[model samples]
Target: MPDPAYRPAAPGDGRRCPRCGHRVSRYNDARHCSPCAQALRREADSCPRVHESTWAEPEVQSAIAARDFGALCRLVRGHAQLRQEDLAELSGLSQAFLSMLEQGNRRLTNIDKIIDLVNGLGVPAQLAARMFGRPG
Candidate 1:
């Protein structure tokens, strides 16, 4: 017999997180529970190491040579297999800003922001130096 005070969570009330099967509130529309989502966000925030061979890629070289941050952002996102939200979190940029930058609606011209982006993406110092025409 079910207790009168016991009420099972209704479908619209909440759902179990797919990752950890933890109860997630309906108010939180994210795919995971708060804890799981936080963990995932933390993981995505870590700097991603770019492979040495990636620097040799024609697209990467061209973007770097042209100093097109929009193109570079797209390339890095693809190479790292990261979503805009993840990349934004890693690079200390907003997802909307990254989207605008990638679409050419915005340009990243601030040196400090550029440094944050490059460092967050784990670009090698030598490559970054070459890109910026600065001593490594």
Candidate 2:
């Protein structure tokens, strides 16, 4: 008898998604494949949503007032419960670009991209005006 904890590896174990019944070449941690998971993420992220609270914390307000772009990005994302990937999806920016901004590797000077970020993240109009000198 096969030992309960010593199940043998099947020929295609961990390489097929049970939900979609699609065979993949590599093993994935989730039952769904990469494309399936990304599709689901897109569907979920497509919903029009915004953070309901204002950036009122003293530290966050200080960061905004200082115009510390990296700190502001971190504060906004953390307060809104958004991951960098989610922010990228919402802001029409690449994860790499956002990471660069957060890491201070890239300067945040482009008004157009900043507007996109402000709109996508649903930043308060007054706060956006203060930060960017324009209400986006």
Assess each prediction's global lDDT (C-alpha) against the native: 0.78, 0.70
Give the alpha carbon lDDT tens digit for every residue of 1-136 in model 2. 3223333336756466545778644544454667886787798877645466647766666666666767777777887777888878788888888888889898777878878877887767767667755322
Q: Please give the TM-score that candidate 2 achieves against the real structure.
A: 0.57
| Candidate 1: tens digits of C-alpha lDDT, residues 19-136 | 8997877566566778997889788767455566676677977787677889988997788677888788778989999999999999999999999988877777767777798322
- Candidate 2, lDDT over the whole model: 0.70
- RMSD to truth, every model: 11.0, 11.7
lDDT of 2 at 130: 76
Where does candidate 1 stray beyond 4 Å? 1-53, 134-136
Whole-model lDDT for model 1 versus the true structure? 0.78
Q: Determine which window of 10 residues in candidate 1 has minimal summed lDDT.
A: 1-10
After aligning candidate 2 to the native by TM-score, how far in Å is the CA of 123 from where it should be? 1.1
Among all candidates shown, the one with the greatest TM-score: 1
Looking at model 2, residue 29 earns an lDDT score of 45
